[model samples]
Target: MEPGTHDLRVLIGRQRLCDVLFEGLGAFMLLMSLFILAALFINLAIEGLARLQPDFFLDFPSRRAGQAGILSAWVGSVLVMLVTAAAALPVGVAAGIWLEEYAPKNWLTDVVEINVTNLAGVPSIIYGLLALGLLVHQFRLGESILTAGLTLGMMILPVVIVSTREAIRAVPQTIREAAYGLGASRWRVTRDHVLPYSVAGILTGVIIGLSRAIGETAPIITIGALTFIAFLPPAPVSAVPPFINFEWLSSPFTVLPIQMFNWISRPDPAFQSNAAAAGLVLVILTLFMNAMAIWLRYRARKRIKW
Candidate 1:
């Protein structure tokens, strides 16, 4: 063989060696990370398993650590999350579609997109401050469920928007071209073809953003969410005509993270246990949301033909 051929073979061999070394290093890092996660979870379960009773979900928080429960906290978390989802879903999805599909390719849209992308990485506290000024004071929404929901919704809005744009962008250009060729209106094509193909991705992003929001303590606390609340919001259903109550939107609230924070901040060991239990629950919830996202993506990929 010629010298050039020999040199080429030596370069290929060196590249494979580098690949093997990196592969081993990556595997080691992965295993070490998993080991740390498992250890932390095991410790939490050991500390809190006995305290994680059914009553933990049913009873109101109390002065006595053993008697205290997360009834109001969990309820508020669910309601706030519901409002967050409701507030963010349509607006984020719509903004994403318009930007990606119809926005004029000009300086203004470019600047808007840049700001949105940058907003996604801004600290949660900045959003909290903004919400406190705009939602709490300027708008007089107060420190209520609606305020908290909208605050968290706005915090995650950029994430949803960015994810949605990416998902829509992922739809093959051929699909959009074919639809246009067949005389489908832009709205119709987006509604029928692009949306269906991208729904899974959009949902995964939304859920992941929600999971991040659910654990946030700063924004909620900054917005004046109560750390301890013994009462539930008014029933969302009423016996009166029209049957649905809107008053709950303005009701004061708490959440699992705040409850955990309250418990952990106390000096009592029993309160520590309670905090551990709440932490366990919070972790489980975050994990479940993430798992749902993974499942949605997997199912969508499996169902897609091309």
Candidate 2:
């Protein structure tokens, strides 16, 4: 064999060995991370699994640990998230669309973009303070469910906006060009081509933003979300008149995180168990939301021809 052929085979063998080593390292790191997460979750489950009964979700918080539940907290969380999604989704998606498609590229737009990117990284506590000053004090929003929803909405607005822009940017420019070449208007092109292709990405961002928002206690607490509430807000659906009531929006509320916080602060071991139980539920709820998003994204992607 030629000396050069021997050297080439040795180089190939060494490169292959390096590739195997790198692959092994990556697999080890991934498994280690998964193991840590699983261990923590398992610990939480062990601490709280006994508390996971029907009454635990249906009853109210009580001084007696055995009688306590998270009914009001979970209800408030659902309502707040509804408002948050309503308040953030349209506004965030619209702003992203306007910025990317309609708005002129200018210094004003540049400033807005830069601020938005920066705001995504801003501490949640700062948003809490801002809401306290602006929504609670200035607007007299009164630290009700509306105020908390708006606060959390604003907190995740940057995430939604950034994710939206990134998603829209991911769409191939060729799609837009083809539509334009077919004489479709800009709006039509965006609606018919860009948005359809980007819906999966947009939805992923929206759900991911919501997942982050669900666990946030600082901003909602700062905005005066109650730590303890025995009563729920007015029913969102009524039998009379318009059939939908908005009174809940103005009603004071508490969420799972604050409920857990309240419990954890108590000296009683039972309360600590309650807190652990609530935390476990919160983690599960978040995971479920993410799983739904992933499923929807998969289905959406599967429908596309490209």
Candidate 3:
């Protein structure tokens, strides 16, 4: 062979080796992820299985520990999760849409972009501190469900915004141009064409953000969420003469992570078991959110015409 051709063959052989090595590394990481997931499921099941009695779901936390169920924590978690989603979704989606579609490429937008990226990396504990300062101290909101929800909403805001932007950006430019060509206004193009196409991605991001918010304990704790609550939260609206009340905003609530933390801190062996059970519940909740997001994405892909 010519000398030039021989050198080229040698370089090509080296490149092929590097590619094979990278592929193997990728496969190894995937297998490791699966193994870790399986191990976690096994460990959680073993710890929580014997404690998964029906009463575990129905009963409230007890001093006896063994008799304690996760009722209050479960309800509180659900309420907080719902409230946080309510507060975060609209704001996050709007901010995302504006940044991705409407915001001019200026220094202000660049600054906003940088701040959002920085916010995503900020610790949950830092958000808790912010909530403490802003909600509890400044606003005098006290330790309440609304305060906790708002704090979590802020904590997850960056995630939701970034996810939403990515989702909107994923929609093909051709569709938007087509809508505009058909005499649609920018708002109409976004609302009728782009938004519908990106709904699944947005929902997936929302669900993932919610999962993170629900599992977080630090911000709520900083905002003075109680470790224990004996009573159910009052309804946000009442059927009585006045009809509406924000009294639910004033009541104490116990989230699952807070309850789990409290349980794990107890010296009793039974509390450890309860903590394990709570952890199992939390894992299940996260998994359910992820599964729903996956299903939504799958359906969205199936519905796409091209």
Candidate 4:
């Protein structure tokens, strides 16, 4: 063999060896992440499995740790999430659509974009403090579910807005042009063609934002949500002619994260087990939200070809 050919072969062999080493390193990193998650879940299951009774879902927290359940905590979480979604979704989607579709390419628009991107990176604790001043103190909403929900909505708004813009931008420009060629109004084109195709991506963002909001402790705590809440919110139905009651929005509330935090802070072993069980429940709830997002994305992909 020629000397040049042998040197080239040697170089090629060295490159292949480096590639294999990098691949092995990547695999090792992934496995390490999975191992950590598995170990955490296993520990939680062992501590909480015995406490997973029907009453665990039905009863409210009590002075006795054994008798305490997550009824009020979970219910509060659901109500607060509903309010957060209501406050965040329409505004985020609208802001995203306008910015992507209508905003002129100007310095003002660039500034708005920069601020929103910056907001997404801001710490959750800062959001909490902001809410403490704006919603709780200035607005006098007090320490209530509504206050907590609105605080969280503000915290997650950037996530939704950025996600919505990305989803809308992902739609091919050809689709919009074709619709315009067909004499469709811009709104009609956006409503019928662009949004339909991008629903999956938008929903994925919303679900991820909601999952984070549901697990948050700082904003809610800063807004003065209690660690222990035993009473349920007022029924949605009322005997009065108005029929629907919304007074519960002003009621005191506690969510699973706050409850778990409370339990985990206790000195007793039983409370530690309670905290583990609550943590497990919160994880299950977050997972369920993500699964629904995945299912929605799958359905959207099947229904829309583009």
Per-residue lDDT of model 3, residues 124-200, tens digit only = 99989998998889999888888888888988889889888988888989999888999999899989988888888
Candidate order, TM-score descending: 4, 1, 2, 3
Error of 4 at 276 (Å): 0.7
Candidate 1, residues 182-280, lDDT tens digits: the string is 999999999999998999889998999899889988999898875568999998888987899889999988899999999988999999999989999
**Superposed model 1: Cα runs more than 4 Å off:** 1-25
lDDT of 2 at 274: 91
TM-scores for candidates 1 onward, in order: 0.91, 0.88, 0.88, 0.92
Candidate 2 local Cα displacement, residue 294, angstroms: 2.9
List where candidate 3 sits over 4 angstroms from the true fold: 1-30, 237-244
Please give the lDDT score for candidate 2.
0.89
Candidate 4 clashing pairs, residues 3+ apart or interchain? none
Clashes of each: 0, 0, 0, 0
Best by lDDT, which number? 1
TM-score, structure 2 vs. true = 0.88
Worst 10-residue stretch by lDDT in candidate 1? 220-229
* Residue 45 in candidate 1, Cα distance off native in Å: 0.7
For residue 222, give model 1's deviation from the true position in Å: 0.6
**Candidate 2 error regions (>4 Å):** 1-28
Candidates' lDDT values, in order?
A: 0.91, 0.89, 0.87, 0.89
For model 2 the local lDDT of residue 11 reads 93
* Candidate 2 lDDT by residue in tens digits, 115-195: 888988899999999999999999999989998988899988987887788778878888999999999999999899888
